[model samples]
Target: MASDSYDFIIVGGGTAGLAVAARLSEDPSQRVLVLEAGHDAHSDPRIKTPASWLSLLGTDVDWNFRSEPQPLLDDRVISLNQGKVLGGSSATNAQVFVPPATAVVDHWENTLGNASWNWETLRPYFAKAYTSPPVDGTMAETLGIDGWTETSTTHGPVRTAFPGDQSHPIRKIWADTFRATGHYMAKDPFVGSTVGSFTALASVDPATGERSHSAAAYYYPIKTRENLHVITNATVEKVSLNRHGLNHVTAKATGVLYHCGDEIKEVTCEKEVILAAGALQSPKILELSGIGNADLLRQHEIDPIIDLPGVGENLYDHIMCSISFAAVDELETLDAIFRQEPDALEDAAKRYAKDGSGPFSSMGVYSYAYLPVLKHASPEGRQKLIELLEEARPTKGDTPEHARAQAYYEIAKASLLDPKQPSCAYLAFIAQFVGAFESNTKSFTISAMHSQPLSRGSVHIQSKSVATAPKLDPKYLSNPLDLEIFAANLLQIETIIRTSPLSTLIKQPIVHRDPASNLTDLDSAKNWIRKNGDSMWHYGGSCAMLAREMNGVVDEKLKVYGVENLRVVDASAIPIISTANIQATVYAFAERAADLIKESHGLKAAGA
Candidate 1:
């Protein structure tokens, strides 16, 4: 092989890209190169501090792409913030490390027709991706009861730790408030049954109190290897492919053409070319490479190589809205430190610098709760919701894409209606507004998120240029089921606030009308949600992993349909959205993909 060629070429050195590259480079003979569109910012303080995560948004490190004005949200053009740095969104996201519910993973396997993708099979990959700190006797008992086995924190590269004594005092108050409201006391969130309120763990190095991103945890340690080559600030324009000789007419990916500085360069891959460019960019790259819909390609004046219609369809994300209340007492919030009290901000900085122990070490979200709307609703309300869901169910359409969407809708409906499964809404309590809303006084924010939304959207190339971002439309609140779920959760929030311990602390609802105002009316609450809702930043399924007959871009092995030596190993490949933050699941996906790639090439799997 030439100097510019490698055994494998992984595009987008973000979360999954770095993980796949790190695992592949374990073999001494296999050469791997990672092409990242953004610069490496592993040492930047803004990325290291958890409290500074919000600051990274709209900055140069952020892709800062905006969606086409969504029709449902009053035609609002929502900002789709994706990390442009090496670690991708994992570096810039709220470091909450909750795993997907077991039922959600089962849904993916059933939908994709891949039994190996179930929770039990992917569990080892999850353990391989991160190392959690040792749980004490009490915590161990809790985890054991929840069926969570211990992960090796001492040996694994990515570090994960609990807040322990460093957590805010308000966490207890939030947890107690949920308990008072009849929500169950959640155990370990990593055990795939996070159906109650609990103080969640974070992807942070407890010893240093810094964000444990993919770059810091997965890439940095192994970057010195001679077999691994990483190019920063390089954008892959399109993959280069050649038609298979004689028998087969389909083009097989051979290399990648990317922009490095002002120079356009091409690098060949002897074995495979993997795409980890995330949900938004991966589909664009595929379409740009002439691997998408034939008509769509011809419209942009690009010659079609393969007509894979599923390249950019089936996009969905978790929609969230913050219901905030002004804190009546002297309870401290991140708003007080970051926006109001300069002295407190300076003190926190000093403390963080000295011992890595302070409010600055965490992303303000202390605890979270996942509740089924039916569980909290009256018998009549449950029946009403079921009726609404059935009415809103997508009818089978003419196209394969439409049928795929309908299938997904059915899965979402089943999950949401099943009381034994995890809830459709996730509630996270923040001591302060955390910049979600503007308030003059210190405030507490409860983020109500519709986890399993029936609404679907897309990301597609507006032009042939890779520099131009794809048009993103998450189509939030388009489904009536989503609105109903959000409304139910908002009512649940109001119920908690109107109760004892929390009610005494809250002064008034800052964002909505008033603290004491009755927001239980479904119509009024739905209106409030429409005006205030935003994405939870968990985007996926732009290039879904499902059966090819269902318009899936990738197969069970994560291989792209109608193409050879190509795979999508990022959030885009996920068939369904998880019940929690998606970072943990993305890491596990990469870990499993690496093993699959290795096994296919007659190489030993990682840890084998």
Candidate 2:
């Protein structure tokens, strides 16, 4: 049985939850409790080994939630994978540690009307969240990693390192190919603007070659602290709130009701209850607590506490589709080592066990390119995209909640179409074929990911039961503009494959489409996307942080509107998805949120 009370009870012991818990527990007087739905994965080999990430996809460590059949994709149900372990998706995701573009952060500040949320104010937290190793001789100085260490009282918990010296020969070829095709080579992608092609860093320690996630970096370091308590395998049912007399509009969360093993329990918090569950589950928790649409709550036989309809409305995620090619016999992919050669695999494992430097230590993705639509789209293609954006407006019957989502889509479309904006399309090259590794063939994949999507979806509780999964409708490629952008980006990827250095090593296309067939026709490319596209697993915006008039679930400070002592500090509060991977941004957001909470409670802030 866990303790009956604490100062702060954080629901969901994932990436954001652990970061907030670590910071809040810095003051020994504050009693902090974190409830995790999954067990502690400290010794799990599948999670510790970077190359073993794919094996954990359908296992118990994964939430393995499936999206509702997407209408745009011939009603195919796409898999939505999220980490259920202590570190959340950070423990399960590819260890790419890239930050968002400056423009994306600027959008959160200007569009959300929060002057303090810009990149400049949040820049310090990015430095505070991770301790980065030098990429090259001068990189530590250029990125100010040394400066951050010298100035700050406490060094960051998470460790960031390069992909090691043994990068595959194909990596350089891909980088050179992008430069030859007229894309600027990014000097360092971590310095705010990620506009060009560059080598990506991962969240791994170079010395030990083990995965560096929130659990290993943040929670475990302070687990023995008397004020910090963590409950594993506990599922939070609902947040228990106390309402003011006769005023349903005002309420304060006092405790949480959850189930641990065979017993149901209740834990009270004297100060606050923070919801750090990811996008899908966070909104479902709110709806279960009667804080969503009044009609939806009444339908579930739960009394409405707040009539905020934006609780689960504005859903956004990156959509990705891959174009795979068979690799030449001279080139060795990760798949070839495991499938063909047994003794070599044993030797590699021995090497990793002895020194932690081998194929098993890396994620196999070395270089990536971010391209704006203007870089690839023709004049006619650009005009077509504008027309598509203009036609994609809110319907007259859309509710206030949905209208707010439509307004955000307009802003996103404008940013994507703006030539000056950093990028809307991401092209990533993996050294191995992702889904078809079981086949007895050596292959590599080029995944074209659309960063800025206009389509919106929702995740709502179908019943008043936390045991049941929520209905998730990502509505991928629902907007014609998304398909249009994907088609243009696919052409750009093919151009890179056809360019000099990479083309010499390339073979025929394996899965997506015939390499010989010309995809110049827009409709043919769009059809191909509908059949092959899926989510990139970067989900957010179900509980966005915007003004109440914009149908926001939480305010700028991450406090849930109309409710006191209740806040959501996770990816769910992100209004717009960032241009790069979201884990770094999530960490930064948690770091800043901890400061805000400390200020409100009159507690001394961490790193003050």
Candidates in order have lDDT scores of 0.79, 0.78
Candidate 1 local Cα displacement, residue 289, angstroms: 0.5
Off by over 4 Å in 2: 136-155, 164-167, 337-341, 375-381, 395-399, 422-427, 432-441, 508-518, 605-608
Q: Which stretches of candidate 1 lie over 4 Å from their true place?
A: 135-155, 164-167, 180-182, 245-249, 375-378, 434-440, 500-504, 507-518, 605-608
> TM per model?
0.93, 0.92
**For residues 226-328, could you state the per-residue lDDT of candidate 1 as single tens digits?**
8889999999999998877555547789999999789999999999999999999999999999999899999998888888888888898988776667676
lDDT per residue as tens, model 2, 43-129: 898898877788889799999999999988878999999999999999999888877777778777776665578888887888899
lDDT of 2 at 419: 65
| Residue 565 displacement (Å), model 1 | 0.2
Q: What is the lDDT of residue 187 in candidate 2?
A: 53
Best by TM-score: 1
Residue 288 in candidate 1 has what lDDT?
95
